[model samples]
Target: MTVALWCILIAFLLPYLCTYVAKISGGFRLKDNHDPRDFLDSLNGLGRRAYAAQLNGFEVTPAFAAAVIVAHLAGNAELVTIDVMAVLFITSRLLYIICYLVDWAILRSLVWLVGMGLIVGLFVVSA
Candidate 1:
């Protein structure tokens, strides 16, 4: 429960951090009312990718939490491994977003592999 809660918090915060980074790099005044389309475009696709990554995190966390809870309810305390997995997923997501923003191709792909591994690992170990 604590792990899921922290994951939810990080999931929410990542997008906000991405948005702020976009604003700073795009030279948009953090206060003025301006079109997001233009500002985001100026960030060169990283802003969009960051937003997508955040969405992905939000979508995945709930199912992961549910599975962990189910495992716990079934008397499998090892479900805590799922909690650790969720953390790894979040970390990889952050790395993926950062790598994409910086155009680090090989490293970005590796980060993506880490995220996928976490998801698969959760199911495999839980079973």
Candidate 2:
């Protein structure tokens, strides 16, 4: 599998990390009947961000994975193009999580844009 595929695997698990963080935060009880939205409110600091990041991670995963798979199989782009975009996408995602946890709003948005661009680049350069 390509590094991009490996990154997709890693991305698959990123949300669980955020969930673990949410549990460690004030919203530790996974069994509660509370709405998921309220769980975020219960968290005061990094915890809230963790929950938000988890949701965001989920939001991005499908598109990323689809793009990676389709691009890998159908893309006529140079291997270097594929590889570079893949690595950068992963790097941006990891950085995005950190930026979320640290509450770096502007930076996180920029990083997200970078990630999104990489995804689009992957698709565009693919056949």
Candidate 3:
């Protein structure tokens, strides 16, 4: 239950926090930059990726939590397994965001695939 709550919080907060981090580090300020367009573009890109990852997390949590909760209600909750998968999913997404930010082509793609597989695995195993 706690994990689920944390997952929800992280899922929601990661994007906002990541965007803020990127914006501040990318020269964001109260005043507009000399080239406002470029600054906006940079911020937009960072925000987009953060949003994409957040969407992925959102997609996973409901299904994952529902499966785990339903199973528990039915006397078959594999709490540890669900928790492990949840942790893995979150960690992999963090790795993914880093890789995406750095433009690490190969490693990013590999981790992306693994992250997808992990989500699929959650569904598969839950059933």
Candidate 4:
């Protein structure tokens, strides 16, 4: 598969990584599994931020995946261009999670914008 396609897989999995962080930091246990959302909602500080990031990750992943697929299917942009943007989007998401955990709101928003721009750029390049 293409690197961009691989990135779609990474994007899909990123939220799970954030979920893991939230769980580990929030002291999740087997009992919490019965009501995981409630357990996640009770988290504070880093755990809460991680959970929020996880939700955001899930929100944006589909768009990123779609952008990559559309770019590939359109077959207008260079494969390298699409791949690089995909990688950059993933990098921005990682930074966004770190920013959220560290309470860097402004930086996190900027990183989020960058990710969004990368997604748009994928479509634009395909044109």
Candidate 5:
């Protein structure tokens, strides 16, 4: 599979990673599994931020996946370019999560913009 395709997989999985962070840090337990949403909702500080990040990850992943797939379907942009953008998006998301966890609001917003730009750039390059 192409690197971009691999990135789609990574994007899909990233939110779960964030949730795991929330779980581990938030003291989630088996009983919490019965009401996972409530458990996550009850988190504070880093755990809360991590949960927020996970939600954002889920929100953006589909667009990123669609952009990658559409770019591939268009077949106008070079595969390398698409791959690079995908990698950058993933990197930006990782940074975003870190920023969110540490309460770096401004930096996190900047990183989010960068990720969105990468998504748009994929489509632009394909055109």
Candidate 6:
């Protein structure tokens, strides 16, 4: 797959990592509830932060995927542009996760902005 497509794949998995952390850290039991949201409400501290990150990860997916698809369809995106921006987005997201887990709100926000910018950059390149 292209690097951009690989980025999409990685993006798809990002939320799951947070979910895994939340589940393991929070020690959520499968029988606790049938509803996922209800189960998620039990998270606290780092687990809660992870849940927030996971939510952000899911929230960002549609826009990121659309940007990538649009860029690919526009036929304006260079491989380097797609690859570099994808890497930047992924790196920023990874850092965001770490910052969130550590309770570094300011840094996490900045990192989130960087990732957003990279997402926009992907759209720009495709345009």
Each candidate: what lDDT? Answer: 0.66, 0.85, 0.61, 0.92, 0.94, 0.87
Worst 10 residues of 2 by lDDT: 33-42
Task: Please give each candidate's TM-score.
Answer: 0.67, 0.86, 0.66, 0.96, 0.96, 0.91
Pairs that collide in candidate 5 are none
Maximum-lDDT candidate: 5
lDDT of 4 by residue, 1-127 (tens): 9998999999999999988989999999877677777776578999999999999999999999999999999999999999999999999999999999999999999999999999999999988
Tens-digit lDDT string for candidate 6 (1-127): 7888888899999999999898888887778557656666777898999999999999998888888878778888687788778878888989999999999999999999999998888887876
Ten-residue region with minimum lDDT total, candidate 5:
32-41
Task: Give the residue spans of candidate 2 off by over 4 A.
Answer: 27-41
Say what the RMSD of model 2 is.
2.5
Instruction: Write down the worst ten-residue block by lDDT for model 1.
Output: 68-77
lDDT (C-alpha) at residue 14 in model 6: 95
Candidates 1 and 6 compared by lDDT, better number: 6
Every candidate's CA RMSD: 3.4, 2.5, 4.6, 0.9, 1.0, 1.5
lDDT of 2 by residue, 16-125 (tens): 88888876776466566466556656687888888889999999988999888878888688767787788888889889999999999999999999999988888998
lDDT of 6 at 12: 90
> Which parts of model 4 have CA positions greater than 4 angstroms off?
none
